[model samples]
Target chain A: MDEIPPVLLRILRFLLERRMLFQLLEPYEWWLRRKYPNPPLPQFSYQVTIHTIRNLYGRRGKIAWASLFFPSEFFHAARLIPFYPEIAIGLVAALRFVQTPLAAAEKAWFSQDLCSYHRGGIGMSLLRLFPRPDFLFATSSICHGTVGFFEVLREIWNVPLFLVDVPKQWTRDAEGYVAEQLTAIARHLEREWRVHFVWDKPFFFSNRTREILLEVEALRQRKDRMLLPPTKNLDYLPYYYEFLGEETSLRFAERLKEELSKPSKTLPHRLIWLHLKPFYSGELPALLEKLGLGVVYEEFTTPFPEELSPSSPLKSLARKILWASEILATSRGRIPGILEALKRYDAEGVIQFTQWGCRQSQGMVMLLREKLLEAGYPVLFLDGDHLDRRHSAPEQLRTRLEAFLEMLEGRGSS
Target chain B: MCTLGYFCRYVPQELLEACGFKAVFFKPDFSSPQCSSLPVPFCALCKTFISWALNHREFSGFVVPLACDASRRTYEILRALSVPAFSLDVPALAGETAVERLTENLDDLARELLAQSGRSFLEFTASLKQALEETLRQQEAFFREWGKRRRAPDRIPLLFSGSHFAHVLLPLLEEKGFLVFPDLPENRILLGEEPLSLTASPLEDLARFTLHRLPCPRLSGPARRTALKRLCGTLGLRGVVIVFSKFCDFQLYEIGLLGRSLGLPVLCLEHDTTPSFPQWETRLDAFREMILHG
Candidate 1:
């Protein structure tokens, strides 16, 4: 798939735009599901990935393009398909289809210094590869890139954009401010779509999903080994936020907990993976295996177990965004969570992978490194692009990982 | 009075002054720090701010505006390093809700500054009202003076827009026979002329005043684009020179929009806190020729 020519991709995109490509993919999806059933996390993830792509690319319904932290439940309530550009670009990068779109975006005046995920998505927008978004929604919660990226998308698509500005300090006034905006968007969406927002449905499903995720976390904590590989855990990033308000997500979470109930691989050193993993290549993952470094927990995949409220659903969403989301919480806010994860997994050290151009995450390295060191946990910093492999040197990454692993082992022996 | 420095215009100078602090815009004149935890991808302004914070001990406190991700993180890093600092969260959107949010934030900032200064509450309120009135007057006078400046017909008139504007480039642009009106946060004299009367709720009025300014690319709304277009037309500008720091997402993202909105030739140049003069000279010369000839 990675080797598929640009011309072929253009043709596929044309077919997909016209809703003919998924028909061709149906047979392939069926074969894939039969060949690799849902017990293994990778196979289950593969099934989910195909369904997500087909659903989103099929363009069967009204779609709203959103940032990572934009509540998926709003779209669910409004009967609109939520498309996350960052996740889509990550998948595209993993399959090696990112080069063309990336170049297209850069040519379109997107600086190479911006996040490649956003740049790649911009490229796709320029090329008209994705379905035309009817609306664009972004949160001021986590990454500042979303505002600029979504603003560009709004210009590209000439669609309405709703920006939910989440405040740094979580207070009643801030909650009300965000809740008012969320309610306004919801009302506007309802009027535009002629649909009543059934917030109850999303709340029910997401709450259940949250419950199961807690069970999974407890199971992982009880285990002495890594429940899943870091790369495999990263594959769940897209699905984590996008599918929260659906029954499919709930079922997947239950299955994930069930899967985690079983025993997993034990390695020399259990390390907590920070930020994002390299999605463009397998060299880092392979290196971790060779170094006998098992990732016990991933920062991006950590869940907030707090359930959404039915009475004040919008406020619940506001609270979740303001208080629960670790991405919004600066480095100091994340220290307690990191320390808890380290203790839970009995992780010997931390690997803080700084994604190229991700200032929000990368800025934390200094403070996080200091805090982690103070907590008696050694941190290894890896600098590379998660989506663009051209920025990564496998030799340099391997050397760093090997050295960190050896240090962990020496600490264990002592 | 305690002298506090700020890099962003959104930091309420009136409120700072009312609270008995001398507020001044601080521009970074240093290279990237030799040893820092901030990533290399951070905009030069941020790295330089970090470098400035580490080296300089002149300011009593630094008011870090939570305007961008880099700025927000820089605040945390400053705190971790135990620097005397205060964070004022600035909303990116412009509207009533955002104005109200900013007003509340500014009120909180006033409290912090007052606490730091140990000024009496009654005296603070009196000073705040007086300061607000004076700021509006100064801004109105500044607007009058700004609009009357004559553009030399011999030199191509251009609007300089971006997050970071190096004033050293002023002489360089002048020497190259180009008249550049810098539309950057650092040039606070060009802020919005919102002739809003000072009300009892001075913070709210100030919030409206600040937000109404020709917004930086970080802010989203029709007001900024409309303001920039109006400024270009009023000044009879031939083109826009977007001089942003390298790796700054806010300025980088605005390049396309400025070209589309301003309806003029757009020359985008990336620089650090300390820019390369020869390279800028070449770029500016070509841009000037393109405007003058073509």
Candidate 2:
């Protein structure tokens, strides 16, 4: 319910009129690619990067804003560009302009307690910075924040919303029901957008998406000895990226494996970070390197999931979605997956980054910490906003992480 | 008898009743805060529920239905507490398959109850059949007896849409000479006659009746405007009241859509289900006065 921030709106009007949003983004994206070069990796990320820019500044209309949890495949099938304001919020945070949106949302009566993603998204929407969607869509979660985020969009945009609600418990019945809903939503979006969706079903292993993902998965199995660097766009890369089910991400994964074929000699402490990490600090991974802690794998990012085969495309995707380690409501399915990741990565410690305003993770922070700590693993339940650095006190985080790392150092050395 | 505590209306009460467990909705005194609760900038209802569960060992077990993130997390918290929690995976989208999903959830709950109660499948079936018959009977009687008796104050009554029952809201409204219908879908379990197919198995019939028939704000395409009009007309309703837990995106959409579509005076109150600020009272009083004296 945030009113358009005058300052933001004025700036956006200028940017929109001049079509300089992505043009302005050029320097930043260019810098990031340069700062994190490992050879042959930049092309894939570069390919995926263009679409994010194009969706906002590319053209007018035929764009759909979606929740992060909504799979990118359906949108791809519909030939509709998926614009996630949540990611936009992240971009703002990465740009260190998050406070403006936060202030706008709070001033407009959005409670400070609401997810920062919602606040940032609403604030951006209020500024008319987000692209106008022909329609809005979301994959529903037990978290009302997801639905609430879109509801704000629907109210502001007055566009038709297509919502696909998922179940907390993963059963064949739930999977089938969700598949049916996804199919319905896909068809609805196609009809509404006046575009027919055709699922890319190649005769066999098209584009080697399966081959690359499986190889990535195999690399993850022996991460202890592998020189795996924390992925550049870690969280969004595996699932949210446009490069998924295509060669862009495949080449990126291939390059990553080639680079990480040999183990790091100096870095001793290996850690697995849970949930998505905020990109507010560009030097976060470098900071981790300084701490002698390298993130070997992310819970959501690793096990590079296989290609979305068109066989029972909806149901198969639904099955993958239902059993998805990260998407499930609570610690039920996620815990086992995380535990598996911890052992597979041979993690010395685990950092459960409890993003600000995300209730799904907040709901399970204590339990996740409890189980991990109880299992003789050093666990740090770090509370920070994913997109808003204002909520994350860097000094406090550093201190806690230092302590956790110290503890892990002792446990590892002894 | 086992006392099974629940928070969301989506969890089947009659299903639990069939399993021979005493099901009770957990309503905390919204005016007072439990000091031991986990203070987060999120749903106060889930925080309060989790806060309460953190200490008390009153219920033998808990059934946390999948409604929103808070409740789902509350389930995780209950499990962490080792409180024999059952998290029901209710669907947000209602359809034939949604009915099947809910049926599976209901059956899972039954299985959990059986494991705890040592009841046979046959016993559960009989209890379910009896419960189904009784639910149908209640639905019939509820509609038949609607507006037949004007035993109370002649103030305009409002149809409410909310997942959690804020018990204190009713008393506060009643003190202001207003009537609030706690149930939104005409019946508590959505056992409305419109969506029921009277399937072969009594359990399947009940699942269809509970989920498929319900027009929860979470679900898409419920013919909600028509349904709201019919229910309101039948009850001689004057306005709609949307009460949701704070930060519940699910209810906010319903609050906005239903408010616009109904073309009636709508009052939205977002409570944390804890005893905190009593700011909602003034709004309710104003809404009540508008429907009556205006």
Question: Where is model 2 chain A poorest over a 10-residue stretch in terms of lDDT?
Answer: A201-210
Query: Candidate 1, residues B192-256: lDDT per residue as tens digits?
Result: 34366777877777888787666778874555677778777767888987777777888777876
Displacement of the residue A227 alpha carbon in candidate 2, Å: 8.7
How do all models score by TM-score? 0.94, 0.80
Cα miss at A303, model 2 (Å)? 3.8
| Cα lDDT of model 1 by residue, A288-310, tens digit | 87778878778777665578887
List per-candidate RMSD values in Å: 2.7, 5.3
Residues B156-272, candidate 2: write the lDDT tens digits: 677766655456567776676766665555443232345244555867777777764446666523355556766676666788776677656556445545654676787767666
Flag regions of model 1 displaced more than 4 Å.
A1-10, A20-43, A223-225, A324-328, B30-37, B56-58, B184-194, B220-222
- Report fnat, model 1: 0.73
Residue-level lDDT for A310 in candidate 1: 77
Q: What is the DockQ of each candidate?
A: 0.72, 0.37
